[model samples]
Target: MPRPQKVRKILCPPAMSGFSPYGIPATDSEPIIMTFEEFESIKLVNYEKMPQEEAALLMQISRPTFTRIYNRALNIIGIAFVEARSIQIEGGNCEFEREWFRCTRCFKLIEGLENHSKCTDCPHFEKNELTRLNPDIKDRIA
Candidate 1:
C-alpha cells in the first residue's frame, strides 16, 4: 500500500472562502475546489515571494511536493480566471497552527476566540456571528 499522506501545517485559513468573477453570477458554473494546502502554497510562493524550498520547509513538506501543490494552485486559478469560474478554498489534509474564526457580517478573520470580542468594530459583531474556520480534525477523519 502507498504511504499515508502527511498532514500539512498551515498558519491560518484564507480570509475569504472563495472568489468569483465580477458581473458573473456564481451559479453560472460549478466552482473549482482548491484545497487549503494548495492555497497555502500559492500564498507562500507567489504572494509572500517565498522560495519553493523555503516554503516546503515551512509547510513541513518536501520541495517536490510543494512545487506540485504550487503548480496545481496556479493552474486552478488560471482556469478559473480564463473560464470565469468560481474558486472555492477548502478541504485539505492539514492542521492550522491556531484556531481561526471569521465574522460573517463584516467578513473579518479573527485569529482566536479570545480576540473575538475585539471584533466589536464589525457592525454585526456577536458571539454567534463567528464561524470557526478550523474544526476539530478528528471529527473529519471519522
Candidate 2:
C-alpha cells in the first residue's frame, strides 16, 4: 500500500481564491486548480526566497516532494498564462499552522481560535503567549 500523505502546514491562506485573465471570455473548460501546498511552495521558494531544503522542512515534507510541488506549480502557472485560463488555488491535504497554547493547569493544548480565557476543567485558561514557530529561513538558504 502507498504511504499516507503528510498534512502540509501553511502559515496563512491566500487572500484570493483565483484569477481570471482579462480580455478573455469565460470558457467552458475547467480552470487549472492549484493545490494550496503548490501555492505555498511557490510563495516560499519564489517570493520568500527560501531554499528548497528549508522550505521543505518548514512544510514538514521531504526535499524531493517539495521540489515536485514547486515544479508542478510553475508548470500550471505557465499553462494558465499561455492558455489565458483562470487559475484556482484550492484543494490540498493541508492544515493551517495556527497558534497553539498548552494550558498550564490541565496541560492541554488549545487552539488560538477557541475561547480559552476561561476553562471549566482548569482554574484559568490564559492563552499561550505568541512566539515565532516557523523556522527562520532568512539566511539559511543551503
State the C-alpha lDDT per candidate.
0.85, 0.72
Q: Stretches of candidate 1 above 4 Å error?
A: 116-118, 139-142
lDDT of 2 by residue, 1-142 (tens): 5666777778766655667888888784479999878999999989999999999999898999899989999999999999888998776766667743444555454556554454456654444532222333333222
Question: Per-residue lDDT for 38 in model 1?
Answer: 96
Clashes of 1: 0
**Tens digits of lDDT, candidate 1, 19-82:** 9999998789999999999999999987999989999999998999888888999999999999
Highest-scoring model, lDDT: 1
TM-score of decoy 2: 0.67
Residue 81 in model 2: shift from native, Å?
0.8
